[model samples]
Every structure is written in structure tokens, then in C-alpha cells.
Target: MVFFMNIRHLPSVFFLWLSISLLSLGGCAQWRPTTQDSVKPASTGDACEPGVINLNRVTGLSQIIPELKKARAVVVGESHTYYHHHLAQLEVIKRLAAENPHLAIGLEMFQQPFQPFLDEYIAGDMDETTLLEKTEYFKRWKYDYRLYAPILRYAREHRIPLIALNIDRDITTRAGEVGIGALNDRDKSHIPAHMDRDVPGYEERIHPIFDQHAGSSKRSFEHFMDVQLLWDEGMAERAAEYLNQHPESAMVILAGAGHVAYRTGIPARLQRRIPGKIVTILSSDGIKLEPGVSDYVMFPAEKQLPKAGMMGIFLEQKDQSVAAVGFSDESSGKQAGIKKGDRFDRINGRKIREIADIRLAMWNRKPGDVVDVTVLRKGKPISVKVTLK
Candidate 1:
């Protein structure tokens, strides 16, 4: 997870805009694989080594699974926007699920309040669109659904339990604004019972990242640290609760690299609740790691998703419609005579009331595809044909 903590700068909107922005940016790390000693058993605490095993080779995966299977929980880290990272995550989940009949997948994307929606999706009670809408996925976890669709679909197909391992964003934002003690009972209910702020090396690890975006203010940094703790501890507690309830099952957790790397984030907090075997794997293009970063490091080749259609316009929700706030240099809508301040009424035949609606309308569209768009210009509806480019 790229920690772009630019919170103090944006006062008009809640902190969620910056949070979503950080998640939207692509992961920055590059991959440089180096050889080390032979693979060893996956061990946590003091016994873990700083070795990274390359999963590209056949033997690398074979050597790791035996050790991974022995663990009660397996954590896999990912760069949210990276297609290859998700592919590797799915591969790991599939491999682990093949052997463990009671395998469950825990997600950091969805909030705990929306777990029922996930359960409904897995139970075939609703379609993908309904699932996304009910969970407020586009509003909360703004990353492209295409990046995670395969894993979600696979879980649904196999009837695998998908655990939502995050608390509501509102609670975190409120906690950041007012200290944990200032929060009301409703917000406090969502927080973990134990928010261990004294985890060894956690603050030291977060300091460098915090310094980059936040100025030299001890108060701001402390607030930032508080928010980070809430994130890790909240997720860990949710995961632990599920595992405790279903001791017969094993879970594969998928979260950002920052939370899993060095075992200082979710993994350590989780260990506090249940001292069972836990293994972590990090997928990176190029991220340097010290000893005990993860049990295995997978080096996947650079892969790209097929280009989606581009409108080249900045959109925002205004009143009851989605408004075109600005246009990019090569905006297809601008070329089609669509002007700024025009509100999107519909794309093709689908209603466009929000930013997510636009994405849904154009999800499968390509650059060369021509789309008929209806926009409200000063309360009058006008139709325009845009050739996406």
C-alpha cells in the first residue's frame, strides 16, 4: 500500500477522498530478484528468515505450499491496481482451496457492515451489479472492479465464504478527527476491543512514509499513527473473530503490501488474539525487504489490463446528476461537442446518476467503440455520440 497521507491539505471533503486517491494510484515498487539459500519452513516470530523465494519457477511454488498448508492463516499482499498481483493472489487462493475444503477468503476491500451482501453474492441471491451497489463498493473501495472480479467470481462459484475484514470508513475518519476516546458509542462499537498502539517497530516503520506527506508536526503524525492502528487492528480483530468461531476452517487473507510486509501490521495484531501458525506472502515488481518481511516473495512479470474506453473527463456528483467538472487534453466528450457543466443523464441506455454509473456504462467499452450519451445542458437533455479514444 502506497501511504500517500495527504490529509491535512484537504479540508473541504472528508478524509475518504484522499484515502480513495491513495488506493487509486498504482503501486510504485519494482522487482529485482536475488538468489538465496534453499527454501525453509514457514516460521513466524524470531525464527523467520529474510529470504525471498521467486515463484516464477515451478519448484518455488511446490516448495512453499507444504509449509503454507501447515499454517492456520495465510496472508497474501498485493498492489491493488496491479493485474499481475491479483492473478498471483487468485493462483494462491485456488491452490490453497484445492487442498483445504473449508477454505475461506478474507477481503480488506469490503466493510464488515456489508458482509451480508457478500454472503448474498456467494449464495446467488443477487447479481454482480446488485452486490456492488448494496455494498457501496464504488463509493468505498474505488479500485476498478475488474482487478478483483475474478477472485470474487471464483469465490461465489465455489460457495466459499468471503469474510469482510474492514470497519466502516466513517469510523476511521471520525477517529482521526477526534481521538478514540472522543468517539461516540456507535462509532466505538465498530472499533476493535484491543487497539494495541505499542506494537514493536510499527511506528518506526510508518514514520518514513508519514514524513513524506505530512509536515514536521508531531500532532499530525500522531493522528496519522492512530488512524493506521485502527485500520490494522480493526481488520485483524474481524479476521480473528471469524477464525475463532470456525476453528475447523482455514483463511487466506488478501490485503495491501504495507499491512502484511514485515509482519508488523495485521499479522502481528492477529497473532495477539490467536497464536496459531500464520504465513505471509508478498507479491512485488520491485520492493526491497529486510529479513522476516514475509515467508515467501513472489516475483511476477509485469502484466497489464486491456485498455478500457476513455471519456477523458473529470466527473463529480452534483445535485442529482453526475457533472462533467473538467476535461482532459484528449477528451472524447469534448470532441463530441459536450461542454463543461453538462450533467450526464444517461450513457447508452443506462442511467448515469453517479460516477460508478458511468463506469458501469463504459466498463466493457473499448477505445474505438462509439457510445450514445445523453447529457442535461441547463436542464435541457441533449444527445451526443462520442467515439471513445
Candidate 2:
């Protein structure tokens, strides 16, 4: 399974945004989102537990939303690689925004440097692709942008403000190497005045991840820890800053669950600095659900962790129905009996309608595991078996 640590979650180097921004700003070649369905009713089960609540339970969902609607700020936690978590987040935002029209959506994907571009995008002054190009979306965030397109669209359609909530990666990378105390006046200006990082549960959770990336600076892990805390607190600080400017606006923050977990990451940091009522909602993708961290926890109907598995095929999305197979260049796709123009219907039993669906099904499968696939070749369903690699 693809593991997501609080520090290294979803795998990308910190503080490299400035360099990435200088690179080519070309948009992704094949960014496509599938048609969305009507909101299915939430599934529920017996959940009186403090930490874990079955999302399908109407009683649980009902109890959670009122508190969210009443808050000045709400944090919705997500696993970046999981599309379903994004869906759940959109649903929560959709429902809550209806109740409170003064809602602003803050994104973790776009950092502080691209705030102007995001503002332009939200203000209808620029197209989404241009905004993404200006923001270096592909290189900076690295996640498939289509997974986030729907939520962004809803915000744009609703005229909701999109707040960029991260600091530049160059500063993050610099802090990781030395310490925040070593920052020059220019870099220091970007950070907040105070970060109470000594929160009890955070160090125990983030230290090992920081250690792995610390290299020879293991002795200076405290410095690296400062960088990590700065990351969380930086986001929290930005969110709080936005709320300060628009006290009537109820901000819905879109961030990785790691930052929102246990109310010990960004939520903890934000509460110390801001006076508004804050609520944390965590979404799970089959990682052991930790309870009592967020005010409400949402679990998708399906539980799959993204893995480093490979199908070795490129899929082209054809409208809302299916992703047609395109290339098989002597990789796993060739061995899997997947021919060009085959329409994918399912992988390991997970239904496929787009390239993201294929990623959802195959991202976490182990390399050697054999799985069954169903595809429509020439208007007929066919079964093909492929061993993951």
C-alpha cells in the first residue's frame, strides 16, 4: 500500500516551489474529469464511537453538519492521492456552503507564490489552464489536477474565494537544510511571528518522517522539525489571516488529512492564533482510522490505498463512459492482453470510467499480484488477467 506520513504524505520534496515555478509551465497533456453523478445517499452503520463514525449513518452525518455550518472555519482533511476523499470533501463543502453563503475555499495545492494567479482564476480574469500554467500546477503539486477540478469548479461557479495556503518551497527546503532561525529577512517576512509547534501529539507522529529526509542533519532534526511545524502553522496562519480579513466568511480549508489529524496539526496551530470556532473533518482511505482528532470523520464506501503498482498503459478518456486503452510499449499492458482501443470497464472489480478510475483501482496494488480486468474491445465485454509490476 502507498503510505502517507504526515510530513512526507503523497511524496514530494518540500520548499522546491521556486525552482519548479521557473520550469516549463505546460499543462498536463491528458487532464480529464468524468461526469459527476447525483449525490448518492450517505451510507450508515452503528457508530456511537468518538473517533470512528460510519458515514452512511444519517444520524452521524446530520449531527456533524450543524456544527460545521455554525463554525467560522472548517477544515476538511483528505488523502491527496485518493479521488474518493476529494469527492467526499466536495459533498461536505457543497452541503455546508448552501447553508452559509459566505464560504471561501482554501487550497493546499497552490502555495503563497501563486495567490495572484488563483485570485485571477477565481475572479474570471483567466482560464483554468492559464491559471494552472502560471501556478506551475504539474511541477509544484504533482498530483493529477483532474481530481481537484470539480471542487475548484464549484468554487469558481459559486464565486467563492480561493485562498492559497502554503509558503514557497524554497523556504521550506532551506529550513529543512539549516533552520528557520537561519532565514534572511526576506524569507523571515513570509513566516508568521509565532508557531507553538511543541504540541504534544505532533512530534511523535512527524519525527520519523522528518528523520528519513534529514540526511546527515539528524542531529539538527529540531531544525527540520521547525520547518515541518512552519509548514503546518504556515497554512494555519494563512487560513487564520484570511478569516481575520473576512470575519463573516466561513472558510473551508482543503488540506491533507495529516495536517488536520488529531486536531494536532494545522487545526491545533490555528486555534492558538485565531479566535473563531474551528472544526476538523477527516476522510479515510482505509488507513487505520484514528478517532477524536476531527469533529467529524468521513469514510468512503470503498477502501483502497494507492500503491506503486503499474499497468504500463496510457488510457484516453472518451467522454463520460470509458477510458480507451491507447499504448502498450512492452510493459505490463502488453502482457495483460490490453490492446489499443479497448474500453476499460473494471480493474480488480473496481469499475472504471476514466483514467482516474484506473489510477484509483491500480495505484495501490502490489507488483506481483495478479488481477482480473474487464474491457470492451469491439462492443463486447472481455476478461483479461494482468500481473501487476
Candidate 3:
């Protein structure tokens, strides 16, 4: 009944530059560097020292070994936009896989719709070019291909299976549109009862970016996470089903850090199903060793931003156009009928050259505020008064 699958390799260039910039900016919050002297390897047969590190605050990587040893599945959390976090996770998988050959790598990148393509790629039935085309997210992230390519090559060369564990994004989007509570009874039956419970104060914890752009998009980014969480739960259920059928095998799931965070995440759900399973978190802040649910945390030597800022208006150099992007809240550019191709000639009475300048010009504005925008549309100058949402 055991199904063997090989891990798929993805290109890694996209994350490298991004991580470097974030690290340099020092914008990532609550980050501190870990020196070799500060972190020591866990000793065999030694119980984790109590009070060795404060649980509420930051901790080192070696503290969670006891939990790691008991895990049948290890899910490493990562921040998709951060290069350091992704690199750290990849390194953790390599070490864990080397120690345990039965480990199979899984990914949140490939959706359910792409499973057949993934299967073909893993089976060596598809060529690299075709495989690249099928998994296009890799290109968008600009991650270096070599980092993930080696892992895929390792799986193929060593006969390890890589599982694609994700629901199709379209399905996820539909679920969000209808609200998680409105799914068909049959579909609802497939989800765990506990998952249906309304998360208390869920809206309070939403990042600032979501709060700002709630009006621009039908579903806010936080709502997107809610949908993603449900998708993750389904993915966990499927992974468990696969594992139950193959009791002798282990799985390593690669996903964004948010999906793998110990609390309210896939690792939490997986641990609930398989109590002794280990969960690891890898990030640029250095590895964290969480007790109880999480077995180990690995962080790189570098310190980087914990998360990327939300999408908002950015000034484009060509034509000085302000475009909306990232995960941010605020009215500017496109939401105001500012076409992507339009040049922002002026904001108010001043020439707009950068986002900071725009913000400075409109700092006191509220949601119902109005501002004058002069745009060069097709070489014709036009003025429009855009009211903020």
C-alpha cells in the first residue's frame, strides 16, 4: 500500500535577491543574530534543559531535539517572500533526509490540478523545460533554480518520492468567495468539525496591509489566509491518509512559514493526528527550538525581515507612474482609475516621483479623502480627483 514518490526540485533565484535586500534593510522586526558560540549541538540521550531558554522570548536551534526525535513527519515553516527562510528550510530538509532515507518531501507550491504534471516530472517522464512551464511560481519568485533542483535531483537519483500537497488555488478562491461556512454539506463533511469553529478575534490580528486594502479586493488578504488555512487542513488530511496507507514511510512538507507556524497551522493539525510527529521552523532570525508541538527550529546566521510589507502603491521609474502592488492597504494608482500604463505626471500640485513623496503629500488624508491626480494618458495630460476608499 506504500506509494513511493520523488521530490520535485524548483528554481531558487527569486528569493536570493529578495532576502538580501530585506536583510540589508533591517526592516524585519524582532530579529537578532545567532553566533556559533551561542548555539551548541544537542547531545544524545540528554533531556532538554528546563529554563535553558525563555519560551516566550527567542530561543536557539538545538533546544527542540527531544521533540524532533519523536516525529514521524517534520514540517518546516517558511516565509515565501523571504529568501533566507526558504534557504534555511531547504538546508534542514537535506540534513533530515540524509539522516533518514525514508523521508519524502512534499510541497504547497504545486496545486491539486498540477498533480499529474508533478507525477510525470518526478517519474522522469517529463523534461526540465516542460516541468518548468508547469510549475511557474518558481519563476515568479526569482529563486535560484539550483537550490531546489538539487533536492529534486536527489529524489530522482535516490528514489525518494516528493508529494504535492495543496488544493487548487481556484477552489480556494471560490471557497473564500462563498465564505467557509457556506460550503456544500458534502464538502463540509470532508472538513474536520474543529476547523469549522470561528476563530475568535481573527480579524483583530490581521496585518495592517489587509486592513488598508479590504475595499480594493473582494476578499482581504487575511481572508485569503483563512481560505489557505482550510486548504492546509485538507492537505494535512490527505497527507495523513497517504501516511496511514504507508505506515513505514515519513513525509517532509515544504510550505510557506505562515502555513507551518506551530500554532493554528498544518504542523499543529498534523501533530494532533500523529502526536509524536516533529515540527521544525526555519527562518532568517535563526532556528527556534519550540518545545511540546515543535521539535526544532533552524535559523540562518543572517537576520532578515520577519514578513514582507503589504501591497500598496509604488512609483514606477518609467513615466513616474504609481502602481499598486504588494499586500498593502490604501487608495492610489489603479484603484483610482489609474491605468497601469498611465504615467503619473503630478499628485496635487507637486510632481510625484516616489511613494514616500506621495505619502508625504497625502499624510493627513482619511478613507473618504479626495486628492487631485494628473496623469499622462497616451501622451495626453488629464486630471482626475480620486476619492480614497
Candidate 4:
């Protein structure tokens, strides 16, 4: 059994509760599934039959029902930018809440600073519109309010404890600037033991995603790993605290897919501290496990949207030298004869693959840079000299 600590705060209690929830959710045990444990046996064609107890697969609400019964906590992995994933998570939460009266839903969106606002909304101290305006990121992520409206509504109507589990973005940015290793021992003391060591195959799993944002100055895989570890450690501790306070209730954590996986992730770190706590990974596709740690792995019978745009585009190796000509104030790309899908072979003798490189070359230059942009126009290479903006 996982032991949780009870700590109360004033109006600021919301932040404390949110932090506690994050820590608890991050602490799932690591486990892997075998070929025999996969969904292949239970799935028929591309989908599973409704009302069947497919332990190897979670095709519909019926399959998820049984899994929800056994675990004290459920962690749903999501692609943050995908509106569909958010919708699916809300559906699962609604089903779980209905099935079990004493259920709490945790979110990765709300940070410690925004906890008071969340508390006010949940406590009916503020109106829905005010709360929504306060949490603009939730609205701006996809410019769709409907994505988050359901969860907020459910939490308010049901009086369910909506736990906020994300660290402040500013803190994350600062951590990124100063490498995790650069942090003093005292500062790094909060990190979990599992995170101290490099797990085999962990880098391999992360590299593919990291390579996608290879050129961005703000995108650092190491920084991401560091912030993730810190967030997971904080979340695990908080979850234990929440469980301590509400032993009768079951919790569900909604976070990015990368943080919820059983091996070399928040779940594994959590399992290290708490034994016998059943950790499950929920994804749109079949759940990938880390051998012997997770008791059950479940995937929803839903199609997942592609992961792009929020992090930016990932160019294929062949499309490396690609140039996307978006209108710069609706003038250059359109009026100056630049079109979309134009391949930029070179810019003033500097071979370019990504848009970042082109921007860097143009930065801080005089009005007339005399930069020659070589474009592959209709299978014919053409050089056009354009002045810097």
C-alpha cells in the first residue's frame, strides 16, 4: 500500500494539493508485457468486441471498467496538442467517475501558481468564465475551449477534486538554462534515485522525439529530461500525500505520454518507493510496458492524432533541405514569388535543411544582405537574391 501524508494550506492549499497530486501520479511502477500479453489475441480485425473483458487490450469503456476497479490510480498518457486525446481522456474520466463515486481526476495543465484559481472555481468562489480566462494556456494550446470545458464542468458538477500536477513553466525554463547537472547537490536533492542513473534504452526512446526539434535553441532534450525528472519526483510525493488524506478515493492522472510509461519514467520511479501499487499505462495504441513492473497494460480502441506543430515540424531526411515559405506580413512569400513546398538548396552558399538555419543567417544583418536563396522551382534550380527584412 502507498502511504500518503496529509498537509493542509490556506487559500494556497490548492497549490499544495495540486503538487501532492502530481507527485503521487508520477510514482507508478515499471513493467513490461510479453507477446502473449499483447492485444492481438483479444482484438478482432482492427477493433475489439464491445462488452468483452479483454485484459490484454482496452478497446472500449467496458474493457476499461474492469481495469479501473483493480487499480487505486490510473495514468492516462496524452499528446498535449492533440484535441482528440484530450477528448478521449475526458470520456474515460467521465466513465470512471460514474463507475466509482469516490474518484479524483488530476490534470497536467494547472501549475502551482494557478491552484488558488482552480480552488476558487471548484469551491464556487468564482464563475466559470473567470476561471477560464485565468487559464489562458488551456485555451491557447489549440484555440479550442471545448477541449477543457468538459473536464472543468465534470469537476465542478461532481465536486471531484481536480488536482493540478504541473510545475511552473518559468521554473522549468530556468532549469533548462542551467543544466540539471549544474544544480548543486542541495538543489538536486529532491530528484528520485531512479532518475540519478541513466536507464538503458531510455536515451534511445527519447532520441527519436528529440531529433525532431534538433535545431531549436529553446528545445533541449537534456533540459526536458531534467524538468521531467523534477516534475515526476514532485508528482510522486504529492500523490502519496493525497492517498494519505483520501484513502477511500481512487485517482487518475492526465499527463503527457512520455511521463507515464512504466520503464525509465515517472511510473518506475514511483514503484521504487511503493511496492505492490498497480501501475497502468493508458494510450490510444497498445500500451508499451517495461517487463514485470506493470500488472496490466491497456490501450484504448481509438485512433491517435499525429504529434506535430506544438513542437514544430519534423523533416524527413530526404526533405531536410525543405523550405516552407509562409508570408512574412503577407508580402515576401506571396508578393515576392515564394511559394509553399519550395526546396531551398542554399542561401548565400550556406546549405540549409531547417527553417532555424535560414533565420539565423538573416538575423542582425543590414537591410541589404544580398542573400541568394536557391529554390527548386518546378524541378529547375533558380537563384533569387532578396534583401534582408
Candidate with top lDDT is: 1
lDDT of 4 by residue, 1-389 (tens): 11111222111101011111112122233223421223322223433232222122113345446656556677766656556566667776787888788888767766655767888888878876566556544322323344466678878888888776665566555677686677667555544344543655565666776677657444477786677667776565555556657878777777777767544555655455453344444443433322332333333234443321121222223456665545445343343455666676776676677554443343324443456677777777877766544
- What are the candidates' C-alpha RMSDs? 10.8, 17.2, 15.2, 15.6
* CA lDDT scores, all candidates in order: 0.77, 0.69, 0.53, 0.54
lDDT of 3 at 85: 62
By lDDT, the candidates rank as 1, 2, 4, 3
Q: Write the per-residue lDDT of candidate 1 for residues 204-232, one digit (tens) a residue.
A: 98999888983657877777887898889
Stretches of candidate 3 off by over 4 Å are 1-69, 135-147, 181-209, 216-226, 284-295, 302-389
Clashes of each: 5, 11, 32, 19
- Of the pair 2 and 3, which is ahead by TM-score? 2
Estimate the overall C-alpha local distance difference test score of candidate 1.
0.77
List candidate 4 segments past 4 Å from native: 1-59, 133-145, 181-196, 215-221, 285-389
lDDT of 3: 0.53
Question: Which scores better on lDDT, 2 or 4?
Answer: 2
Q: Name the lDDT value of residue 141 in candidate 2.
A: 75
What's each prediction's TM-score? 0.82, 0.64, 0.53, 0.55
